[model samples]
Target: MATPSSPFSFLDDLFNRIGERLQPPAWAVHEIQHRAVLFLNHVLQQEPEAQQRLLRQQGRVVRFQWRFVTMEMVATPAGLLDLAPAGSVPELTLTVTDESPFELARATLRGGKPSVQIIGDVQLAAEVNWLVDHVRWDVEDDLARLVGDVPAHTIANGARRVVDALRQFVGGRKPPQAGGPSTGSASTAE
Candidate 1:
């Protein structure tokens, strides 16, 4: 007798097939890389120290990749990032080691770092690590600029709550109590 097929397995296979078939065009990829650089620079601009670090690494190329998508960026003396030529050799390359997009998204939503494999210069890797740890996008500030401060604050708080809920669901654990340690196990004392 043949076993019944799992719906989840079938759905996973279908999604993989669709993803493979829907590869973005080269122009679209380039545009996306450009926009990503712009966003990174915007964040870096907020942190003067980050900009100084990037300025020190000026002219060095760093390639960032996740699965099939790759972008090569060069640090400028102005502390901004520019999209490097596709053919240019990078001094450092950072490849996302995790294959599961869902896991990556979950980690990001929980404010956790995604796993990455670093190749090439150690100094560049250190600089990159420092930037990652220090620089953060000021989403609330940006929203406040577009909308009113009160609405932006409200939206930011709502988003934080949703993220907390998602983290609890995905991690199968309640958020740690403020000023208290997390106990992953369920225990009771009478």
Candidate 2:
């Protein structure tokens, strides 16, 4: 007798094929990375300290990888970033440890940091961490320029509330302290 295919197995196979077909071309990937670099540089330009940090790392190549996508960027003396030349060795590499895009997006929307592994230069990693902790995109300001200030503020507030709700729904509870008593109901009397 032939083995039967499960519905979930069939669905998974279909989705995999669809994803393969929808993947962007190399040039599109390059364009997207270029835009991302531009956006990062714009945000960095707003902070003099961030620019100074980048300036200290000028000529250093940092490679960032998340899943199958990778982008290598070089810090310029002008304290901006540019795409590192192909075949250049990176001085530092940062890899996002989370494999699930949904989980990563949820954490980001919840204002939680995504876990990452750093390899190579320690000073560079520290600088990058400081930048991550301090720098934030001014989405509301950008939106206000496009739309009216009132609408932009309203939209931003709504988005924040939605993200808060999602975070709560995603089990945002903190874990019990190390070596401390359990916080679960089972640990409580009655």
- Local distance difference test values of all predictions, in order: 0.87, 0.85
Q: Clashing residue pairs in candidate 2, if any?
A: none
TM accuracy, model 1 = 0.84
Task: Write model 1 residue lDDT over 1-190, tens digit each, in one string.
Answer: 6553543555546667887899988889888888888989888899999999999999999998887778899999899899997689999999998765666777887678999999999999999999999898989999999998999999999998988898888778877788697558868999
Error of 2 at 37 (Å): 0.8
User: 62-142 in candidate 2: lDDT tens per residue?
Assistant: 999986679999999999899999998998999999765665766776778889999999999999899999988888988
Q: What is the TM-score of each candidate against the true structure?
A: 0.84, 0.77
Angstrom error of the Cα, residue 172, model 1: value is 1.9
The clash count of every prediction, one per candidate, is 0, 0
